[model samples]
Target: MITKKPTNKRLGEILRQANLVSSSQLEEALSEQSQTHNRIGDILVRRGWVKRETADFFATHWANLVNETEKPLKQPLGHYLKEAGLLDDEQINTIISEQDQGKLWVRLGASAALKGWLKQSTVDFFVEHLFPEQASDSPFTKAKSSQKTAKGRRSWFFSQMK
Candidate 1:
C-alpha cells in the first residue's frame, strides 16, 4: 500500500495576502525559484524581498491556522495596535475614549497619529503588517493614498513654479 504525502497550502499566497510580499516580488521570487530550483521562501529571503523571521512567522501562522491548533482573535483595533507595539495601553484607552465621546472620527491608528502618540509611518507599518485586509478595505487608507498623490502633484506644481 502506498501512502501519498500530505500537501501544505501555498506559502506564497498566504504571504501575498498578508501583504508581506507584493505580486511583483512574488513573481520575481517565482522566476528565481524556477531558474535555481530553490524554495520560494529561500529565494525571497536571498533576494532580500523579505526577512527570514517574517517568512517564518507567516509560515507558522498559516500552519497553525490550517491545522486548527490555533484560532486568531478578532480583537478591537486598539488591542491590535497595542499588540503590534505601536500604541501603549494608555494611548489606546485615550483613543477609545475620544472615539466614544465623539471627539474623534478616525481609526485607532489615525487617532493615535493625530494625537501625536505615534508616527504616521509607524501606524502604516503595523497596519500593513498586522491587518492587510483592513489596509485594503479601509476608507481611511484610501484617503491617505489620495492625500499622498495630491501632495506629490502639488509639490511638483510648486517646484515647477520655482
Candidate 2:
C-alpha cells in the first residue's frame, strides 16, 4: 500500500523536525547555498553539514527541493502539505492565483466575463450563491434589499475601489 507524503509547513519547520542540524547551522547552510547558487542538499553535503544519506533523504523529501510542476493536482494544495493533512478544503478553495504555463485560469475566466465573453447565466452558475438571480428587476430583489440593509456586507460586496 502507498502512504501519504508529509507537508513542508515551512523550510525552517522541516529542519526542526528533521533535527539533523541546529537552526543557526541550517540557516547558514541555506544562506551559503543561496550565495553560491548551489542546491541546498548539495551544499549541505559538501560542507559536511549533513551526511550524504541525510542529504539524499531530504533531497527527495524536503519541501523546497522539489519542483512544483513535478507534481500537480496530485496533492492539489501540495504533496507535502495536503498528503500530510496540513491543508483543509477551505484552504484549497482559495487557490485563485496559482497558474500553469502562460495562463491563469481564474484570471482568464474573469477577463472573459468582463469582456462579455461569458453569458450572465454562466457567471451566475460559476459564482454559485454569491450573486443572486440574473433578473435584478424581479421580486427576487433580496440581493438589493440585503445590500442596503447590511452596510458592511454591501461594502464588502462592492469595495473594490480601484
Candidate 3:
C-alpha cells in the first residue's frame, strides 16, 4: 500500500489561517504569481498588500512544517506578531530604531515586552504556534520571559537627537 503522510497547508492557507493576509489579497497575489512566475509572497510584497516581514513569517514557518525535500524560507519575526495582532508596523519600527540605537542588540519579542507593546506570554504563544518544530530549542523557550537588563534598553534621547 502506498500510504501518504498528510501534507502541510500551503502558504496562502497558512497566511490566511494566521489572519496575516486577506482572502482577496491572497487571491490577487496568487493571480499575479501565475502571470509573473514570482513567489506569491514577493508578489504580495511588491503590491503592498502584505508587508515583507509578514510574508517572510509565513514562508519561513510553512517551510519548517513541510517535508525536508522542500526549501526553507528565511523570514522575520514581525509577521507572526503582526498577524496575531500583538504588534503593528509602527510598533515594530519603533522597536527596530531602539535596537539600532541600543549599545547591545535586543530581540524583537523582548523589546516589544519592555515597551509594553506585547506581553511576553503572548509572544511565547505566537512563537510556539508558528514554529512548533523549533519552539522547544529556541531562545524564546529558554528565556521564559523577555530579556530585561539595563544595557539591553535603548536610549530614546540618544537616537532621537542623532
Candidate 4:
C-alpha cells in the first residue's frame, strides 16, 4: 500500500508527540527541511540519529498535516538567516561549518552563532537556542497529553454528538 505523506508541521508534531524530538529540535529541523526539500526523517537519518526505514514507516502511517497548527520552516540555514536579517548566507555557512564540522546539529548552532540567531554558549547551542517564544514555551505538550486523553476525549465528543 502507498503511505500517506504527512505535512511538514504534522510530521514535526508527530515526532514531538512520540518523544523522538523536542519541540525546539523539531522546529529547527523543520525550518532546515523546508529550504532543502529534504524530509524531516531524512535529515535526522543524515545526522546519524534516525534510520531511513523507520522514517519511511512513520511517513506512511501517520495522518497528513491538513489541520496543522502552524506552517513548517524549510529555508536553508544561510538563506533563512539572511531572510531574517541575521547574517548573509556565506557568513552563516562559514561559522556553522567551522564550528560543527558540517554536522547537522552543530551546523545549526554555527548558523545561529554566526548570524546571531542565538548565543554561542547555549546548551546544544543550535538545538535549544532561538526556540520560538510563542510555542507555549513547550512545543509538544499538547501532543503528549492528547495520547493520554484520547480515549476520554473521544467518548466525550461522541456523547455530545448523540
Which RMSD values do the candidates have, in order?
A: 15.0, 18.3, 9.4, 18.9
How much lDDT does candidate 3 score? 0.58
TM-score of every model? Answer: 0.42, 0.32, 0.42, 0.32
What is the C-alpha lDDT profile of model 3 across 1-162, one tens digit per residue? 112234467777676655556788888888877898898878877887667876776577544433334443233456557653457767876766755666325567767877787666655545555444445544423233334342333342234334
| Candidate 1 lowest-lDDT run of ten | 145-154
Query: Model 4, stretches more than 4 Å misplaced?
Result: 1-9, 64-162
lDDT of each: 0.57, 0.40, 0.58, 0.44
- Single out the weakest 10-residue window by summed lDDT for candidate 3: 149-158
**In model 1, which regions exceed 4 Å deviation?**
1-8, 66-162
lDDT of 4 by residue, 25-51 (tens): 777787889899887888776875444
Candidate 1 residue 83 Cα shift, in angstroms, is 9.8
Ranking by lDDT: 3, 1, 4, 2
Clashing pairs in 3: none
Best lDDT among the predictions, by candidate number: 3
Reference-based TM-score, model 2: 0.32
Poorly placed runs, candidate 3 (over 4 Å): 1-7, 62-162
Model 4 superposed RMSD (Cα): 18.9
lDDT tens digits by residue: candidate 1, 16-129: 664567899998888887898988888878888666765665555535433432343344444544433345656765655665566755766787778887666656655554
